[model samples]
Target: MKAVAIQSFGSPSGLAVIDLPVPAPADGQVLIATEAIGVGGVDVLIRSGALADYGFAEGHIPGSEVAGTVTAVGDGVDTSWIGRRVWAFTGVGGGYVEQAVAPVDEVLPLPAGLSAVDAVTLGSSGVVAHFALAHAHFAPGESVLVRGAAGSIGVTTVQLAARGGAGAVAVTTSSAERGDRLRKLGATHVLDRSGEGDADAPPGYDVIVDIVAGADLPSFFARLNPNGRMVAVGMVGGPPPADFGMTMMAAFRKSMSFATFSADTVPVSDRRAVRAGQFAAAGRGELEMVVHELLPLDQAVSAHRKMDAGEVFGRIVLTP
Candidate 1:
C-alpha cells in the first residue's frame, strides 16, 4: 500500500508518500480498496500540527474521507458486503492510500447511480451541512445567510437550504467569480465580504450559517433576526473575535442560539442518512459537489499546498 504520511509537523511540503503493508481488518471491520480520497481543511490542519495541541499525533496518515469497494471482511461482518461499493468516515486516518480498514458499522452503501468520486466529494462537508441546516430548523419561505458560501461546505448548505424551500439564500464571497458560482448554486443573493456594503439586515435573517468566524462575527450577528440561529462550521477567516461582547449580548437578547457542526461527534446513522439525502439531491440536479481538481496519490503534497493557498474552489480528490 502507498500512503501519504506526515513525519513532521510543518507545511504541506512535509508530507511524503511511502510504501507500507496493507492493513487487515479486525473483528467487526472491513477493508476497502480505495478509489478516491477526499482532501479536507481538517486534514491540512492535522498535517501542519495545528491539531497537535488537541492530541493528534505526527507521523499519522492524513485522510478521513474515503470511497471505494469492499475487498475483505472480518469476523462478525456480513459477507454480502465484500463486493459492495461504499463510503466511510474513517475516524482517525489511513484513507489516503490504496486501501482503508474501517468498522462495518461506519461504512454506508453508495446510493445507486452515484460514482465513487461523487460520493467521496460529499465526504464530511456534506454531512456537516445537512446536520447544521436540519438542526437550525429554518421554515420554508424564510431567509437564510451562509458565510463563505462559495466553499465546499457553503455550496452544499446553499443547495440544501434551497431544497428545503428557503425563500431566499444569501451567500458571502470574497471574489466576484465565486459570488457568481454561489448564485448558480442556488443563492438568491451574493454579498461581497471584501466590499463596503450593508451586511446587516433590515429586520434580520432567519438563520446564519457561518463558516468564517472572527472579529466579523459581531457584524454577522447584527444580521440575525430575533430567534435566529447561527451555526459555526468553520473558522477559515481566523479565530473568534477578541471582543464578542456585543455579539453575545445581542444573541441573548434576541433569543438567538449558537451551534457548532463537528462531523466527528455526529452519529454514524445520522451521517449515513445525510449522505443519502445529499446523493438524492445530486441526482435531482439540485446539488452539485464540485471537484476543483483531482491529483494522483503521489501528488498529495501538491494537493495540500493548493488547499493551503486557498486555490481550490471545491473538494480535491486523490485518486489511488
Candidate 2:
C-alpha cells in the first residue's frame, strides 16, 4: 500500500510518498480501503513539528479522518461490516494511506446518498462543531461569532448555529468572496480576518466559536456580551499569548467565560451518535458539506501547502 509520511519537519515539503506493506485489522479493529482522506489544520501542525512533543515524529503517517469501504473486520467484529461504506476516525495516524485500520467502534456507516468526499469533510468536523457549541452552552436565539469561518469546522459551526435559531451569526474570514459564500451558508455578518467591521453586527455575541486562537484572541473578549461564553476549539492561527487569560479577568464584571474544548473529552459513544446524526442530517439535505478541492494521495504535500498558505476555503479531500 502507498502512504504519505513526514520525512522531516517544519514544511509541507517534508511530506513524502512511500510504499508500505498493507496493514491488517487487529483485535477490535476494522480495515478500510480509503477513498477519501480529510486534510485539516492539525495535519499542518503535525507536519510542522509543532506537535512533536505529543509523539508525532519523522516518518509518522499523519491523518485522523477518512471515508471508505470496509474491507475486513478483526477478532470479535461482525462480518456484516465488510463491504459497507463508512466514515472512520483513524486516530492520529495511518489515515494518509491507501489502506487503514480503525477500531470497529470508531467507524460509522454512511447514510444513503452521502459520498466519500462529503463524509470525510463533515464527519469529524461536524462532531467537533456540535460539541463545541454544546460546551459553550449555546442556546437558540443567542448570537454566535465563528472565528476563522473558512474551514470545514468553521463552516459547520456557522450552519449549525444558524439552524439552531441564533439571533445573529457572524464570521471572520480572509476575503469578501468567502464571506459572501458563508452568508449563503448561514452567516449573517462577515468581518475581516482581524475581526473588524461590525457596522451591521450585533453589539456583542452571546457565544463565540474561535478556531484561530492567537494574539488577537484577547481582542475578541471585548466583543462578548454580558455573561457571554467563548469556546476555543482549534489553534489554526497559533496559540494565544501566555497572558491572554488576563483579558478574561478584565471582563470579570461582565460575567463572561472562556473555555477550550476537544472531542477527546467527549465519550466515544456520544461522539459516534452525534457524528451519525450529522451524517444523517447532511444526507437529508438539512446540512451542507463543503469540499474545497480533491487531490490525489500522492499530492499530500501540495495539499498541506495550500492549507499552510491559507489558500483553502473548505475541507480538502485526498483520494487514493
Colliding residue pairs in candidate 2: none
Query: How far out, in Å, is residue 210 in model 2?
Result: 0.5
Give the true-structure RMSD of model 1.
Answer: 2.2
Please give the RMSD to the true structure for each candidate, in Å. Answer: 2.2, 0.8
Q: Of the candidates shown, which would achieve the greatest TM-score relative to the real structure? A: 2
Cα miss at 255, model 2 (Å)?
A: 1.3
lDDT of candidate 1 at residue 179, scale 0 to 100: 75
* Best-fitting candidate, scored by lDDT: 2
Residues 1-320 of candidate 1: C-alpha lDDT, one tens digit per residue: 89999988988888999899998899999999989999877788788887788888877898887999999999999999999999877776778889999888889888777788888887678888888887788789888898877667887889888878898888877777887887788887778773234344334688888888866876877777788888888877666767775666845778877787777777778787777777777766667878988899999999988887877787899999
TM-score of each: 0.92, 0.99
Clashing pairs in 1: none
**Per-residue alpha-carbon lDDT of model 2 for 230-264, expressed as tens digits?**
99999998889999989989878999999999999
